[model samples]
Target: MKKITNAFRLTLSLILIAVVFSGCLIREVEQPATVKTGGEFQVKLTITDKTADANAHYGAVCVLAPDDWEFVSGSYDSQVGTGIFLFDSSAKPVYGNIDSVLAPPAGMKWIKLLSDAAFTNPADVIHEATINLKVGQKTGDYNIGYFTTKNSADLLGSLNMSDEDNDNAWSDTSMNHKVTVELAVGVEDEKVVPTKFSLDQNYPNPFNPETTIRYSLPVSGYTTLKVYDILGKEIAVLVNGSKQAGQHSVQFSANNLQLTSGIYFYELRVGDSSASDKSEFSEFKETKKMILTK
Candidate 1:
């Protein structure tokens, strides 16, 4: 046997400790039970860093979803939990797109999430964020799987990752995190009436040129849908003087208006404008956010 240096032994011990205590794991995942076809939904993820003592390291979360579902860039990076690294997808490993790089499955893809968020210091620290995505025309029940990696050994963008990472890499399929997409039937499907007033999030957000805004009306009256800039400045009026008690959609085209790219708000005022008191006349008033990418 060859003589081993003291430095070598100490270094080996540290590596083993990291592998054992690199406690980064997804603690919980929240997803919607049902979403309309071609509608947008969000996934809330809670990740915990559990260790006796903390080490300065990084972690990542990968979501397994069908290829038909589009990943819409939204606030996943903005609302990272306290003491977490700055979450950013721009740092994603780009070995020729995520699908070809991770090779999820025949009909699905792997969406990897990373953070500047850290759990350094006392153990048991956690991080939270929401991922936005849009469903396609397909309507069916689907399972969403999650995979996590901790420790400094396999940081995201690590060139060392091999080609073997695929559907097999995403685990815990039985966790039962599933989303069901129902067929989208418009107002033409008169059999189905909306139980309550609601406004769905815009799909393909951070959209350039055009995007569609959808709203539901339990009881019909006069309605007006208008777009406003971040400054509360009125931008465009997409709809006015509407009727019918059913789902409705309006297309907003920024290209035609020559509007610059920025965050915009859309307000839905449903009720009667002919009434003396405008506030009391309105049955419902709701507003939602959408991003414009010129």
Candidate 2:
């Protein structure tokens, strides 16, 4: 009887440990290994609220970058991700410059994006953010940091402290992530921006199930990327919202679509977002074909 009681206590202790450590799950969706001297580098983050606290919610996402990367306030494009962490009806991210008495860890700076997203109930919510940057002339391997919080108060105790020692730096293992990027020297631009609109063909022309599509925009606009069958029926809407001016890529897979082996066409459409009708077309209405084998 005593052994049974001890086993019950052990199971209860393990459950408590899991509850204490599981807060949010942040994963590195996509990133670059190397970038040109003044070229575009991208990072995609997938964050899910696991604890889903009813008292306070997470509405802000932050990035910790090396100062030499020169991630100035006006350097890169900050577009609203077409995810649940939206700022308004049109889905734009509220770019904020957090400068004052607060500073990030030495040699690093924080880029905070506040949204109207919530974990109001007990359900888990997922949010994604894609950040595109044109790094400076500095060339070397550097680590980029990422985190999300409810507000500034949760971050006050984390400044400059080592991640292993700073309990307040982040809530769980997923909240604190580090990504390394190698930068090479090349033609440096005064500011990083796409020169024009372009739509590259799908990679791995004869992919069995998965492939990637790349595109670029010189300016911010309402854009849509779609995949169609040989007969022109829409199969998937890859992107349909406002996109910041820079280089971007999206992946397509056939596992969920139950697609058969054949030729497929993908189209990219962009227009001036200021007008009521954005599909009138100013620079791009391009389509390309790719082959998928079963």
Candidate 3:
């Protein structure tokens, strides 16, 4: 009887140890290796489990930009309150039970995450979030915060962790994983704005008889610009030839053709370089709407 009782006690102890070890084996979350100002960066939160029994509920993650940065757009999973945004497996933004924007920036960008779903199994679940931030040209130091809930009731606390340390605890009472990012010289300052090409809007938007269109080029190349109706049907060819870049204009007179009073679109295409010695020509195209009030 004593031997049987000892065996039972040992089995119970081993089972408890295994359960604790399994819980701590959740997948590690990681931030992007590189990101650019005014560009999109992917942030992933991965939860790995093999038993399908290890689940997380009311999970959330947020990226806090530096004081000089600003938030442009984001892909969130679920929204609990004001400053929070939510996203799903398909990466679509969805507003949750919360309505008011929780944390409005006094002068900078801030993002938050909130959810209430209960996890039932141990499976690797990945939550991908995209955020566009505008950073200054100067190099500096920045910090990012990651938070999540172990259970549903603590969702709000998980959304508020931002400080350096709370015994490694976040605002959501979850494990806090704070990361520091460094900005290098000449890394974030370079800007790329389209140059050497300009497409202008048509004059007299709502015209009774005619209107004019204009475009400019910086170098010589084969260029083509054509106009199309709302149905994408070709209507007029404005310019089609190899011409030197600098400045050029085209006038589309509506009197000659059978016309309708509606919207129109246009596009321009530049061909590739034929030889390695020559630089490839850049292409620029834009569309403008015209109205025939007649």
Candidate 4:
């Protein structure tokens, strides 16, 4: 029978080359959920080998933040294994290298690593991984992600991935990649309450004897800040007490008051009803103008 039909076609071509060189196939080229608190975000994970035969390594991609947001320090960097690798001496085919690692702690600020070159070949492969957050004046929502390893297996327990908000889902199959990030907490309003009562103008303005007079009281009353010299009398008070509406700054050390420069005036008072009615309170007075160069 022609030697058993050529030994059954060489045993089905070595069993289809051992089922295409076994397993290991990760995927996830830039998985961004959404990022916009301080701006800057990126994510990408990939590992393949349907039959490329050997070559896929990844270790280091851990990002987790939520506590007002703060990670702006040194900033790390790594685009898939540092570079330099091209072989073909005699059919050493095992190409498919990709690596991207980053670690940002102690203030956080390591942005850049979505893939610079790992096993490259994700239908063409692409890379991107960035992180930078600093928007917290008390608002709301936030979450982050990242974690993976290969060759020794730990693909973050199987790999399916899911994150609508931010909680650490999981994904890793040698390189089946996956990512998630969400940050939504608005309404900072620039802070600085004190909508009406005005009095601001005393910063370095011809200041040599000291300057810094700002005032604004709209509600929580019982306040007072004084400083006068251009024929107004009162030479020092700074602040009296009670103050809690937002925006407050006091520092006018004129060195015990000697008097020798030019114009200077700063006054602010609030103590009518102490803001009690349903109006949340509103009783303020203002006055500003400073210039004391000596």
Best by lDDT: 1
lDDT of 4 by residue, 1-62 (tens): 00001111100000000000112223333333333444323233333323222355432333
Q: Model 2 scores what on Cα lDDT?
A: 0.50
Residues 1-294 of candidate 1 have per-residue lDDT tens digits of: 111122111000000000011344454555566666666565555544444334554444455566676565333222223311222354444222334434465666565544434444465555554555666676677755544444354333332132132222211111334456677667353345677787655655657888888788888777888999989999998887856888888888887677887778889888864676544536888887777776
lDDT at 14, model 2 = 8
Off by over 4 Å in 3: 1-195, 272-282
**Candidate 4, which segments miss by more than 4 Å at Cα?**
1-188, 192-202, 205-212, 216-218, 222-224, 229-232, 235-244, 248-259, 262-291
Which ranking of candidates, highest lDDT first?
1, 2, 3, 4
Write down the TM-score of every candidate.
0.54, 0.40, 0.32, 0.19
RMSD, one per candidate, in order = 13.9, 18.3, 18.1, 24.4
The C-alpha lDDT values of all candidates are 0.53, 0.50, 0.40, 0.39
The digit string of per-residue lDDT tens for model 2 on 1-294 reads: 000011111000000000011144443334554455544455545555454455544355554555545321111111222212221221222222233323455656544444433335353555554444445555545554444444424332333223332323333222223233434433343235667787765555457788888888999889999999999999999999888998789999888897888878899999888878877867588886777888
Who is ahead in TM-score, 3 or 4?
3
Error of 2 at 110 (Å): 2.6
lDDT of 3 by residue, 37-123 (tens): 333233333322222343344444344444554433333231221111332322312322111323323432334433323344434
Give candidate 1's TM-score. 0.54
Candidate 1 error regions (>4 Å): 1-62, 72-106, 112-141, 146-174, 179-191, 272-276, 279-282
Least lDDT summed over 10 consecutive residues: which range in candidate 4?
10-19
From the highest TM-score down, the ranking of the candidates is: 1, 2, 3, 4
